[model samples]
Target chain A: MTFVTITFFLFLAVAFLCYFVMPKQHRWLVLLAFSIAFYLFAGWEKFLFVLASALIAYLVGRKGTKSSLVFGIVSIVLLLFYAKAGNSILAAFQMKESIIVPLGISYYSFSIIGYMLDVYYKKIECEKNFFAFLLYMIYFPQILEGPIPRYKKLAPQLMEGHEFSYERFCFGAQRALWGYFKKLVIADRIALYTGEVFSNYKDYSGIYFFVAVLLSSLQLYTDFSGCMDIALGVSQCFGITLDENFRRPFFSKNAAEFWRRWHITLGTWFKDYVYMHLAIHPKLLKLSKLAKDKVGKRFGKSLITIIPLAVVWLLTGLWHGTGADYILWGCYWGIIIILSTVFAKEWKQVNQFLKIDGNSKGFSRFQMIRTFFVFSGARLLTAPGDLKVSAYMFRHMFSLWSFREFFTKGALVGILSVWDVVIVIIGTLILWKVDLLQEQGVEIRKKIGQYPIPLRWVFYYGLFFATLVFGIYGPGYQASDFVYIQF
Target chain B: MEEEILELLSAEFPEVDFTASDELVDDGLLDSLTITGIIATLSMEYDIEIPYEEIIEENFNSIAGLASMVERLQEN
Candidate 1:
């Protein structure tokens, strides 16, 4: 069920009631049953696929053997590959693929794989209790788009019996409502304008395409982070704390920092499972040492760091989708970050020679704006269906760089007006400001709560009204699925 | 004994000043990933496999705790 839908609210209400009323020890059972029922409601046919996968993982994990662990890992990987690429494989065989990728299969498969790997490596003990394992894998809130809870982070919480707390509930509900505002009101509305321009990019000129790129970036952030807020908020209602996903990504002065802030869980997952492992490989270490001895520490560190980053980005590109544009987008960011690091010393030298203050507030602000534009331009490649169209879009973007044509013109006027742009800017600023505060270890809500109740209530009511009036809801415009769900 | 482990810790994390009585896990001195790295290193250096159950914070509370565990494993 869509998090924004009435059916989801109903399910949550029922689950909440049952969860609180149930015996303390059996609270997990209540959640497990509700989760299963929720998944079944969403996609009953696919329930069997999820169930079979979960069971296979559980059995393999419980019955420990080196070979069993290897087999389990292989089986999970194969299932994911088939789920992801089954149609292409079927076409090659001259058969129409009957396999429907279960809703949330991409997400839960990672959870299952991570769990099995942890167990295999003996990093974490296997959960012999089938229900506990199921709950960890299928918790409804995160089943869709995950913070991708590790086994250790989630399993103990499921085992702990939580007494209902009014404070926790209030906090969760407020956060959920805030998420709704972001997703339905801000993100979906912005999407309308971005979708219009991007879908017809061939007809737009310089500034128009530029605006579209900016709007698309904002829309994606709001939609994905909004979904994350709701998922995390819902999990909070049950006192199951999921990891924070997005920080103030836009505030990042560099692409590397941007990755650290955006989709944080996924970045860390790649770091732990992929990057760090490869970074510390004996071959790479030897190469790094050799470079350090030959070329000096400065050049060696840059080479070592940039090489691994390139590989990580390549994998990251392929992981997003089986498309060339995505690959280019990933490589593009990778190159940007590498260049930034490679030129760090030179950049400092140049800044010093030019007598420019790198620490000046105005200069920093300009750099941030420049970085945003550059990132947006790179992401424009992601909008098109293929590399050819993407290349055409890029060519047109540069070729038709007339300020008058963009401001005066055809496709731009039809897509976004001044008011829409204003709203998007305001919304993005608010999100960035909030994330910045949180990153600095400020307790935003707590500080807000210190205000007079009447003021707090006013703020709350204003948020609610804004959402209700502006939220993109009606027939024929389905809530777009969370982008990370496909991963 | 704890001082020895602290020396190792100091070598790995130059910024950290390890104390024998410090609550390493609770103070966030060691994150889960770091813990995994430590376990892997301990196994290789000391030729001891730490069972999953032994990974609890009680056995890794301080340098002394880890050293004691390592000593026990060596004896075994």
Candidate 2:
């Protein structure tokens, strides 16, 4: 069930009540029961798959010693591959119909694999309690989309004694309300415009298509990060901490920094589990040394680093979907980042040598704005269906056309009002400011809470009321699903 | 030996102070890949094989903890 649905809130309230009312030792059992029930409520067919996977992982993890842990690891990996890569495998089998992916399979599979790997490595001891282990894997708050919880981080909290706290509930509710506002107001509104432009790219030209791409990026960020906020806020009510997944990625100075901020858990997962391992390979090291000696230090670093980055980005693209466009999108990012890194030192030198208004604040601000547009242009490649369509869109975007006609279009104006655009810009700025403050080690919620009751309540009520009045909700509007859920 | 290890970390990540009591893994000071790098380096430099299973946070919780693990491996 969606977080926005009335049924979900009803289920949450009932579960919350039962959980706090239960005796201290039995609280975990209450949570486990609710989690299973919730999963079954969403889809009964998929519940079986989740159970089987969890059981297999737990049993193998418990039985296998460190030396024999490969069996458990392999089993988990194969299951994950089968579930996640089912469509590709089915295509190979010459199946015609679209293969149904089990909901949350990608997320929970990773969590299960991470748990098994941690257990095998003895980073965390194997949980003898089956119920607690099951609860960790199937926790309802995180089951749909995840801040994929690590066993070491979450298991203790599951086992910990609980007492209902008014403060925690208030904080979680406020956060959830804010998340809903982002999803309904900013993201959904922007999606209306982007959806129209992208659906008929051939019709739009010049700045119209370019504007859509820039807006699509914002819509995506708000939609995906909004879901994460809801997930985190819901989990917080249970006193379970899920990882913060996004950090104002739009404000990042470079593509690499953007990856660090966006879908943080997934990026870190790839870095820890894939990229780092390849980087430290004996073959890679030897090649790095050879290149450095034969060519030059600059070329060597570029060659060595760029190869791994390319592979990582290629996998990242493929992981998003089986589409060629996704693959191209991934490579597009890979090229941008690699080139940026390659010329980084030289770029700095050029900046120094030219001294072209280098000291002026206005010049630096202009450069930042230029970089943002450049990044958005590269991201347009991510939206098209194939290379042909992508090229067509690019051609239209650059073609010398009637600028007056584009601005005067009624459909464009109808889809996104002047006030709606203004609201999106303001909302994005506020979100970025909050993220920047947090990055600098400031706790925003804590500071906000510390404000006098009248001021704090006013801010809360204002946010809630604005969401109620301005938020997009109707028969035709599909609650835009979180983008990363496809992965 | 501990001072040498600290020196290596200090050179690698100059942002933080490497200390005897710091919980590298638990406190998020050092990520999993960095730990793997340290393990690989230690294996090569000391002619000691650090088993993957033994690369848990307990062994590398602190400088003293890591030193003790290395000392034990040397004894073996």
lDDT of each: 0.76, 0.75
| Candidate 2 per-residue lDDT over residues A1-487, each given as its tens digit | 7777768889999988998998988888888998898888767877878888888879867975754466765766676666667777778899976655667877787787778777766667888988899999988888877877788888888877478878888788888888888888888888888887777777777777777888877777778788888888887887777888887766666677777888888787767556665655656655665786799855654555677678888877766665677777788888987787668768778878987666576765666576577667666876554567667778888775666665565333746777777778788787777767976889777888999999998989988988887788767766766666677
TM score of chain A per candidate: 0.90, 0.89
DockQ category of candidate 2: incorrect
What's every prediction's RMSD, in angstroms?
A: 4.6, 4.1
Per-residue accuracy of model 2 over B1-76 as CA lDDT, tens digit each: 7887777767744655657346877887776435655665555456676655556678877877777888888889
Model 1: residues with Cα > 4 Å off, grouped in runs? A88-98, A286-307, A339-358, A401-413, A417-422, A436-441, B1-76
Off by over 4 Å in 2: A65-75, A83-85, A88-96, A281-310, A335-351, A354-378, A385-387, A400-403, A410-414, A436-442, B1-76
Deviation from native of the Cα of residue A472 in model 2, angstroms: 1.1
CAPRI band for model 1 = incorrect
